[model samples]
Target: MDSATHQSLLNAARQVFEAKGFTRTTIADITREAGIGRATFYVYFASKEEVFAAPAHQVRDQLVAAQ
Candidate 1:
């Protein structure tokens, strides 16, 4: 429930997503990179797409902020 753990997941997901692209990335891959359990991932996110949206929006937000 802490932001640290939530952000950890996001950071890990971003790394894996950038490396593998969305189609090739899996829940196991993200959890492994995040150093967390699958249940832990589910506790924060309902699905991979749900997790993906956050980072995607983050990227968008950064772009908007920079302009």
Candidate 2:
């Protein structure tokens, strides 16, 4: 996928995972929030767990950069 599409998926995944928690959120939920299709979500992430982890990793990177 293109960078815009990937970022959109990541942003949507982050929102859904944050709101509902990883275990409770579904691919459909992320896709709906992202205004994309469920298959599109799958193209970007393997699962909800990965979605949750992605933001956490991003936060960690930001913190490290700030330090």
What digit string (tens of lDDT, one per residue) describes model 2 on residues 1-67?
Answer: 4588788888988888779888888889888988999887778888777777878998999999999
- For residue 37, give model 2's deviation from the true position in Å: 0.9
Worst 10 residues of 1 by lDDT: 1-10
TM-score of each: 0.90, 0.82
Model 2: lDDT of residue 2: 56
Residue pairs that clash (backbone atoms under 3 angstroms), model 1: none
- Worst 10-residue stretch by lDDT in candidate 2? 1-10
Question: Scored by CA lDDT, what does every candidate get?
Answer: 0.95, 0.84
Q: What are the runs in model 2 whose C-alpha is more than 4 Å off?
A: none
Please state every model's RMSD to the true fold in angstroms. Answer: 1.3, 1.6
